[model samples]
Target: MKSACATKYEQIEEPDMANIVDAVLEHEADDRPAIVGETRTTSYRDLVDLARRLTGGLRQRFRNDEDVCLVVSHPGLEESLALTLAGWSLGHRVAVLPPYLKSRELEYALEQCSPVVTVSDQTPDSAGSVAFRTLLDAPASDLGSSASEAWLETFTSGTTGHSKCVDRRVSRLSDDIEQLASAMGLSADDKVTAMTTALSTTSVLPALLAGSTVVTIPLQTARQFWKAISDTSITVISGTPYAYEFAGRKKPEPGQLKNVRMALTTSARLRPDTARRFMEDTGVSIRNIMCSSESGHIAYNSSTDEELLAASVGKTLPGVTVEVRDDAGKVLPVGQSGRICIKSPYTATGYRNDPDSSAAVFQGDWVVSTDVGYLDAQGFLYLTGRDDHKIHFGAAKLDPQELEDILLSHPAVDDVLVVGEAHVRLGQIPVAQVVTSRETEAAELLAYCREQISATKVPQRIEFVDKITKDFKGQPVRPKYVRFD
Candidate 1:
């Protein structure tokens, strides 16, 4: 399942205020389909006009030129993109939101952005919120006259903790789109399936802007996902490793995804088992692309080389540089794991309104990642775990990723999460919440772990679960594994 590696790099040009709106302007008169949704289809021509109308609607309704929050609740809907581009056309910073947020989570995001306007299929929590349909039906007006650059705000996956906003400008987004597509070797004719990330800068933008047809489908099961690929003749796919596991389990028909030439997995680590199994079933090796909300994409792994994909996300994508530095800002020598920092042409300005947090992560053109990994001799980035989520067992802090990788080797173990819980004597003790496909006991897993890792790193308690649920970003919800204590 080895694929083509990134062989070219290019300088990112700062596009004018077109943001996303300018993407389809070339086909304004041509009726070629640009976005294929589950419920509707938007031709390149209609996409432009609809977004223009929405732009007029935004101006007529809420004239604030700052930020607008778009709740992308409906899957495969054209209006979400239309409204985003619509907002950008007016020099408005558009913050795209996931639909799965609880009331409290949604409130936090809304409060931070304080968007002048909000649009969603559901009633948004913001003050000036309006129905998506209303915005879509508004009379078309000329694109906004403001020359201010539009911004894009995305949230961190928050798999191990809370989510934060990553505010980047549209000019940066344009360059990011080019680098990501080049890394994946995506082309204008490459039909792409965006099950969850139809609006994300990484997936849809590359194809949509390049005039490649983008297919959006409801992410219910692999059956439906594969069907969309077959129906639309999808040639490229981007999603999380969590979703790809299902596609492999369902097993596609022989040559069903023959049109799908490549795929990219992000958000969380792509387990070797998941990647190889999918490759075996579908002949499509999953390349684990390292991406961040603050920075669009940093690395690309095109090959399924066992040692490479298992340890490293990949080498740096085109026009991207990954540097490893120590706590005092000294560049660590190669192979020495430390802070994973990325430098590229396009990057988030910072986390919105959180100056302290923003200062820590967004340092000039570099996005200082909390991830801990090192570059191999050949320049591949190997991400071990987050710097913050170490399991502290009486001052002997352990990376959960290392421990989980050991538990994953078990025959019956399907998935595992290791976390530290407060204990009177140990200060904190390791607890393992494991997902299994067949019969297994905590005692058996404990014994298996003892054989692989040291006892201090082993889970003191093991809890069995049916499955590990993921958030909207397809990140596993790494809650404290709450105990009644």
Candidate 2:
């Protein structure tokens, strides 16, 4: 899908922090709806008050430029937003930790970030951190701060071992807010609910910073999301591909999302079929955005149809430049696929404490990393696969996304994953792990692939599975075909 209109180029401007908070505050008076929960409706004014109190509390415990780790807190949007804004306003860095992290993972993140303050409802018993708080019932402080400091330290989403921090300059955040506000046509009257966790760079600040009243559903269950959208009168919805797939497969009640004018999916590859089903089920079609924490949102599929939106993640957002490159770092032709690099105002300065890794991924002004794709003649970006997972089979290389797209088109297949694995003979082959309708067989699926794609591009083998799993951020993880003989 093409962008709505080419954004006019303009010099980057830094937003006034006090003005941003005040704009959101002013919007609350005329635009916000009463957020309904188990107890009752919470006015926007009430939410602002809570944020002020919570920010005060967080400020008191963690001084300016200190690091804080936040765990998933339930059923409280005001408290969470307050803590996040407070942390940012006070020039403290915040790290969002997933709730399902095992003790080992938690320990690793804590040790890596070395946060002076840990703001979570789930404080581990053995934690000997500098300062810890439950974040509720804490007293507010009057600490002074400057806007030039770091606001948050977002860990890399794809990393599995010790987390890597991307400490972003707080001043760059407004660039994203402006992009979202323009791309999505956001207004203060829009009540936004996102399936994304607060820890993500895109989800938390952009909605609130765009002057929209933000509502959140605890991500434990999809049903909670349904409830929050209806109860909060959410007009805008944000989620990852997996979350949108769940909504499609589960066929959630339609009444809950009647008021939603737009639904957005980003972070991972979105299947075209899933987009089709989502639009058919809900009146709202999916808005797929291609983005990274390093460079906020680079592009968005603004078309309301499922196929175009799904075909490509879409054209570049305002103030961003995208290019495809080969191993030699030379630019590739429009149709040729290679490493996808982005240049944006919001791009990270460098990865924190990992200059070697940083230098490997970034050039003079662009973030050059694992993403692999190409832009079309029409300026649409099609993400084929991750550079790290590129599959070399005999004479030709295959992008997993290319194969997965073909597999997902099959009626019998519900979800599919393509991954590269070592093969003694071939060196590496594309293995497909598929979740399918009960009647579908591996042989039949393979036959279907033969008709759809070239034999070299077809999967070496297909495995029927009961479920396709996703990571916390809702991207497809391991393809279900784990070979253990």
Candidate 3:
């Protein structure tokens, strides 16, 4: 019996399979802003010329088959984008390293991909690396087609452990660009505010392919973020829940974000309160998007309803099918919570050089996500938590996200993480590390949790911290908590 997930990639004939650079070069006469940075803007013509020069530089430094890793030290820069497009144009596999990874994490990434050439903002301590600026000095080189199987290698967030390198082909990316652009209603006149890092290529690439000018902003602070949106006349924006949480802190003036038609959130879950508050202040709806590194864009909340946004991750996108399955892989009925498995044309082939992990997750055409979720009767998907994150407390299983979400709803709480702590009596008990506002007391927080959730779900120990450490994906880094003797 054939799996319902199995679907062939719809073949679309085009002059170029590598869409980004090809589109820019072909539309050089169009002379519109392709990339807008903090200090300057790159017109489509300029972008094409820059890519040509960079391709020449890359060709001089490395062979066509060699892999190149882009470590984006400086976020929202045109250099990173140029180098990436150039590598694709030259038929070399390009790996984009996450911008927020620490030194140790970066070392791990280098070991995993082991690219022949690394383009970075800072001088890499490792051999066979060059500064990004040097690429601009190279003379223009002859343009070439992408390699037949050339891939864009992206690493997982490594929050759980070491990141895995997921290799997605250029053809797959090209197909996704069209699908996403059509779904998002992107057009040539739109100005997209790219709040995500360079690693989030889908966020920026789809907009670029739609002929929209991408306005890059440093999402370091709320003030800077709002100012950028206001100044750039941004029509669309994509970011994580953490960015919106920061935005919720400041009240925007009337019509400040009026130009923004859609505000998309991904990477981390967005709390209902955070969405409602943001909508109240900015008059823009916060749409939660559920996606993965392996599978491109899976589901999105298309509706502007705040209540729906808070409850569900929205309906699956066109050409994407989602199913909930039990432990034995039998499909579960709607509203029955189980593992969330996705079947999509845009799913990546497999992980690069990690067959064991690939075989574990990717079964035939379906990418069996580690996330646990359920589907409503209306086809709306509600993510419960990660399957691995479930805590076995006595005989009762508890999801930490549920407790964390309840705690996050409190007015004084800034951020919170709930993890299992070893207990002699119960085997493991829930413990919460919270970052709160100045006035929020530990006792008050505990009382609030007691009021919200069941006794078993409540944290056995509550410790207040200055801030919660997060990985590149804005997910809480699980800490090695002190064991109670």
Ranking of all predicted structures according to lDDT, beginning with the best and ending with the worst:
3, 1, 2
| Structural similarity to truth (TM-score) of each candidate | 0.73, 0.69, 0.74
Q: Who wins the TM-score comparison? A: 3
lDDT of 1 by residue, 164-264 (tens): 66677676677677666666777667777776634756677877767788887556777877877788898888776556755665887766787888877
Please give the lDDT score for candidate 1: 0.68
**Clashing pairs in model 3?**
none
Compare candidates 1 and 2 on TM-score and give the better one: 1
User: What C-alpha lDDT values do all the predictions have?
Assistant: 0.68, 0.62, 0.71
Question: Whole-model lDDT, candidate 2?
Answer: 0.62
Per-residue lDDT of model 3, residues 397-444, tens digit only: 466776787789999888999888765435468888988876766788
After TM-score superposition, the amount by which residue 400's alpha carbon in candidate 2 deviates from its true location, in angstroms, is: 17
Off by over 4 Å in 1: 1-19, 64-76, 122-127, 144-147, 158-161, 303-311, 390-485
What lDDT tens digits, residue by residue, belong to model 2 across residues 263-372?
A: 88766666666777777777678877887667777898786545777578888987789989998989999999888888777666656666666666556667786777
Ranking 1 against 3 by lDDT, winner: 3
Clashes of each: 0, 3, 0
For model 2 the TM-score comes to 0.69
